[model samples]
Target: MELTLAQEKALNALVYFAERIKPLYLTKAIKLLYMADEQAIRDTGVPITWLDYKAWRFGPVPEDVYNKVKQVDNLQKLDAGDGVLYSLKVSDAPADLPEGLVLNPIRPFNDDEFSDYEIEILQKVIDRYGKLTSEQLVDILHQEGTLWHRVVQANNLKQQFELKSNRSDYIIEFTDLLDTDYKKAAFEVAYQSHLMQQNLM
Candidate 1:
């Protein structure tokens, strides 16, 4: 399948982080992107990217994004100095080679591509988690009662054999991350926006 909207947003989020958090390790980068989506899902009652997260040892990883980045690793290693993808010299990904996509200095993304809500979410997550290392972030994700925790602890057959989790499935109005107050506000905002759009239609 072609890149989904969330996938494109995931890439855009990466570009945003790379611009600010220069010399970002792919490991930290991926985790940051995941957190951005999680934070937005919590705040807005919707996810920035509807990624199918696999509960990897570090945290929840987008399996497709991981594979794609891994496939690009060889090219980054060989052509890091000159490759367009690694024009900034995506350094060695800290996580096992190929998985941590070390991003080089790349151009900042165009602002036009992101929604106002997306921009706000990305900035908020970065501001909150910017200084955190991958290990620290992993610990946060590993906390009890987290989506990562429940899915991993359960260890269903799908998880045991194929590492699948429907927990990460995307559905509006279904995020467990958001607090009740936040959910209420989000629901109100969404309802208002829906009504406005309907009026226009």
Candidate 2:
């Protein structure tokens, strides 16, 4: 399958965190992207990336991102001495934003790998979330009132929710979780979690 714009952005984001915050695990990387897009959509009426996220057991994730991480050569295994860690593989590519996709309404600058505002938001997210473990991120996503919990509770989906790939895009029509108000509320939940984590750190 042709990769979606969000998947492309995911790799770019991986590269970014690798440079700015080394030794990030795969799951945390995904959560960071999800948090950015989710928050941007609520606050600005557009997401930093046009990725559609589902309420997965671990948290909200772009299906495209979940699949790509399994096989993409762009991610490398790090020798963290004991436990595993992941980082972006080397390429001279400029980390430019892909074309032919909708983007966040309020951005940092003119051209859009991400807007300046999106970058600012990302910086805040990464600084807060990046320091935590993957397990910690999962717990944060699972919190009540967050998008994942709301989706599961609304639909009565069981844990480890099983979904066929064919049914992926189909869920969009039934779920208004993407609506602005819900998105705003969802963003607040994650943002509050970020604040709480900051204090503990």
Candidate 3:
């Protein structure tokens, strides 16, 4: 599938984290991206990458981004102009990635694909979560008040959560990240505008 502009940005974000974190594992990179998007939604009523996160067993997983990261073997074929240009070399791992999949960036991260606020948010995510291991990040997401935990609880699947199962996944709403009713309503407006803009392209 062709990468949407948002997906391009998300891929670049993967690259960004891979550059800063040595031996960056796939799951950890995804979690860091989710954190950045979550923080951005909290602060600005909008997500930095505009990726649609879902309540997964490990935490919030952006399925498209997850799939894209998995396609590291084929990333060199994608040539979306004006997007972050790079390729990923996947380190050897078992099929299930029990030890987590490592990603090595083969090109420089392109900051031109993002806004100033987005850059700040990414840096903040790195600063806050960059040091944590994949399992540690998952622990944070499993906390009681986190969005992932709330979704799992609301669906009565906290104890029986399954990974990559259609029956267990729930789409994470961006508005749910906002604290105030006013912010949620404003987010709806902004989201609608974003959709319209995407449709025009």
Candidate 4:
């Protein structure tokens, strides 16, 4: 499948993190991206990467990007058209390699694809969370009042009532990360406007 602009940004973000941490862990990369998106929404009412996240067992997972990484891991390279190449190189097979996916970028990330604000936000997220392990990040996302935790809890409640429920199948709304009703309403306006612009495009 062809990569969208946001997906390209996601890869670039991963590459940026990989450059700093050597072979970045795949789970950590995804978690960092999610955190960046959530922060972007809180700060600007827009997400840097408009990736859809699922309420997965570990945390909020950008399932599309995660699957793309797995595909690239097996194929060694993914061409996003226009001769742009995104590839992953496997590092050592540690005990947690199966779950960790220690990977390095084959090429340098293109910062030209991002705006100044986007780059700043990404770096901010890295500064805050880059050093954390995948498990630690998962713990943070699964904290009592986190959006991921809320989705998981709601799904459990639904199941307890014998209602239709799928824990990992639920989409975690990024706006839910906003703590207040005022923020949520403000985000709804911004999100609807974004949708309109996308339609015009």
What is the overall TM-score of model 3 with all chains considered together? 0.85
Show the colliding residue pairs in model 2.
108-115, 108-116, 108-117, 109-116
Q: Cα RMSD (Å) per model?
A: 6.8, 13.9, 3.2, 4.1
lDDT of 4 by residue, 1-201 (tens): 456666777878888777777457888888998998888888866787778899877788888878877677443444434422244565554885556577687788788867799888888988888888889998998899888878878877435324543336688887666767777777778677757756664
Greater-TM-score candidate between 2 and 4: 4
Tens-digit lDDT string for candidate 1 (24-142): 77778788888887776776766666666777666778877666555555655555353234433354556644444566546556566578988888888889988888788889988
Best by lDDT: 3
User: What residue pairs clash in candidate 3, if any at all?
Assistant: none
Candidate 1 minimal-lDDT segment of 10 residues: 165-174
| Clash pairs for candidate 1 | 88-104, 88-105
RMSD of 2: 13.9
TM-scores for all candidates: the values are 0.67, 0.61, 0.85, 0.79
Question: Candidate 2, 168: how far from true, in Å?
Answer: 8.4
lDDT of each: 0.66, 0.56, 0.79, 0.75
Comparison by lDDT, 1 against 2, better one: 1
lDDT of 2 by residue, 1-201 (tens): 344455555656555655555445556667888777666665664566556676666667677766665554333333323211133332222346222111121112222455688778778788788787667888988888776766667776652356533222212211244566766666567556645744664
